[model samples]
Target: MKGRFHEKAPDDIQVFFPNPESEDPMKDEVMWVTVIAHDAASGAFLGILLNAPRHLKDVQEGDNVVFHLPPDAPLPVAVGMGGERLGWPVTAADSLTETVVRGVRHYRQGRFGHNPPGIQACVGTLGHVLEPSPQDAPADLRALGHFVLARCLAEQYETERAIHHFEEVLRLTPEDEYARMGLLAELSVMVHTSPDELKSGTELDWQERYLKQMATALERIKNPHSLELLGVIFSEEEIKNAAESNPERERKLRRIGAGAFRYKVR
Candidate 1:
């Protein structure tokens, strides 16, 4: 019989049953066999049929038997089944969407603490599967994957990578407030860190232009957090003093600062 062993055997090896359509005389049989266990150093194996093949009872425990796997058999099932036996959760039965969903769940659960390698591996696998595009997966799952990846990168202090993923999340879901806020926060960090780079004339010019553009964008958002962030990146003192002289602008900045607590807490 041609088949593959399902797992390692000590005294008895469990083998997969060959397809019934094959030329084997016992094709209609649904029987299995446990090969007699041999020492690890020995290459010999013996098969003991569990059903129907009583004639094989004459076979000695030390007798060798050949097993063959069908050419058309799926390899993923074997690999996934083996991995499951070894304690990994991944399996051939899991779809790409299902894998990504499990990754997201793992990410969320480990986000607040030190993430283990397994969780990182799960999320990284999801990224590889989803990257370039989500293929047939749902658009929302893709967006959620990006969002989770962004947060993971951010927590790992990979700011630029995190920013890229966050931007991707926003591109897929423009109305995602959490991603928008995350983008703003990352931009704020970039602005905060740019002061040293500003000594270079080209970099200084770029910083100035970026700050102005972001300031305008924040004004359009009218969100208190964005406004507060803008005030920090721009000139908080200048705006506050100017507001004192201009009643209308003063009310606007004040309203923007309303309920703003991060800067205060810091």
Candidate 2:
């Protein structure tokens, strides 16, 4: 059977399976497979199924088979606060978000030391995901990698670095609403907690200005996904507070939403 995932296998990359064999992956019980070997020349892969296939009747958990990735599959699942994850992690960004959550939980419980080391390790892990290397990184993965790194850096008070990463996401995928909203959330936190942290670095022109960056992001957003729906949860005050009170920009935001938007608010 052809695997219904668009991705061609790369070393250390996992294979995707669409459960229920449906066109709408959102409604299906999907599975992921760990590829043992992939032949780029032949478009074939040797892999062990990581989990039982809910729809692919011939496959069972731990089954080894030779195959080629087929059709188009979903992106690496979104990872963060309230982000949905499926099966085992297929990317480093998935792992980092879990680590960040654990660190936050521990720090809240009087384990103050959990904060620093966790942040440091996350930084190292994320830095490895980037750099002058060639890996089969999708735009979604690249944006998420940068987005998560930006959050970690922001928490560590590395505002400039955080801005650089957020801007990188916008640079990579201008229409990414999560990163856009993330900038808003980060700006809210900075405004309420550490306004002094907002300053310049040797990066994009919009690096130091959260509102400006967000304005640019709003203008450039070409692709909005269901994830943008998460922005609806943000209170008016939270959304209003994130950006400076700019009526023109707010009008533009509303206008954008009017045309095509799953990414309203925040």
Candidate 3:
């Protein structure tokens, strides 16, 4: 059975679901929970899955154990569930977003303050799943998912799939410069690299197609940084001509080129 949705997993780690819920419906309802494990090193995603609880014969969806509080804080501490501090860690007022972001920042920065696998995983999984709706997904999560999926696809050497993911990110966040840049970057690779480069007789050379598509994407992007980079690939004369031919594109490409120069220098 599928598990709940998760926003963002930890950085530099992969999560694994080795102990999935038991299939015996008679023992317990199918309790399932997606545990976000870290990479021990950089703490990126290991994977996610349902974890079976101790002493619970049957597992219902979204049912599992949680050992709240840092492991080294001291022995005999109480644990909390669903935001209630029934046991330890000295409850304090803070938004769930703040809490999760804090932990993520810590792990990513490698400034973790004595976070054991238990505490890190506990808070990491907090608010892990956004409301079951497209609108409910947090912007940062959406962004991260796009980035992660792009990286994964790229790793598999699927340039077009990776570019599509980045393009989706641009669609979701028109104002996001990084996402825009990423989309253009990946698209450039896809169009510039011909299938012949990869192997002919299978498909049209993607690199060549990507080169052709770059012009259209550059025209649409607002960020100047991306525009300038595209110009590097497209040539200034080509860009100038395109801008002259289409006023709207001319304005957008100018801004993109200007913005690209502004940031690309750094």
Candidate 4:
């Protein structure tokens, strides 16, 4: 009755339900989960509610269910009456293994799409780093491994390493909007906005118009459709200010467009 639930989604979204007594916990109670899937291609989203133990209790073999949860979200366990399989790490391990093998195969075939499948490979490496898994990975995997690790670090607010990862990703895909925006967002967070950072415009109206245009570009890039293709042109300061001033609206816009948002310089 005291186990955790584990689910993994593509990109940086993973969820775990921890044992009640787990150390360094985030939440105490195992409540209902609401998953929102933002389209990696267009940022359009559709979400669903998941009922804890009860929902998964009926899962059968060969069920084509796409699980969604954070890497560290806690799970629940049921009693014997529910035909529960307790302490079974192999189920999760098998899922992890398949993802890695598939990722490597795709990477070798140059079919890694645009992102190089770091999120999947990172999940495997994360398992090895966290547990004593017997995954025989190679040295070259380190490059992609480091990329995902850096993204994880960034999501956790580790500014320095995230920036480093963005740089590396940009090296591989020069026109990558995500990496470029990430770098700009982080820089905006660390560095103060200078008047010189603004474009050369003697008139006040011209400066305002320029800032608004930059802000509009930032909003457009938040859409995954625009992001993955040509990245929008904008000043980071204007984007940061817009994001900060309209936090709620911006978040809703981000969920609709994809998961892109300019991190406020807070």
lDDT of each: 0.49, 0.48, 0.41, 0.39
lDDT of 1 by residue, 29-115 (tens): 234455543334533333443444332331222222333333574321111121131112333234755555556555644533365
lDDT of 2 at 245: 84
> What would the per-residue lDDT of candidate 4 be over residues 171-256, giving only the tens digit for each residue?
55555555556565544333323435433333344334334433544664565754433243233444445567677745432322
Per-residue lDDT for 136-226 in model 2, tens only?
5556656656766676676576655665677788778777666776665554344333225435432222324544644665466555543
lDDT of 2: 0.48
Residue 199, candidate 3: how far off, in angstroms? Answer: 8.7
* Clashes found in each candidate (C-alpha, N, C closer than 3 A): 4, 0, 44, 17
Candidates sorted by lDDT, best first: 1, 2, 3, 4
**In model 2, how large is the Cα lDDT of residue 66?**
49
What ranking of all candidate models by TM-score puts the best one first?
Answer: 1, 2, 3, 4
TM-scores for all candidates: the values are 0.43, 0.37, 0.34, 0.30
**C-alpha lDDT of residue 58 in model 4:** 31
The segments of candidate 4 whose C-alpha lies over 4 angstroms from its true place after superposition are 1-51, 54-148, 172-175, 193-266
Which candidate has the highest lDDT of all? 1
Decoy 1 TM-score against native: 0.43
Off by over 4 Å in 1: 1-94, 116-119, 194-266
lDDT for model 3 comes to 0.41
Runs of candidate 2 exceeding 4 Å displacement: 1-116, 131-136, 185-208, 216-266
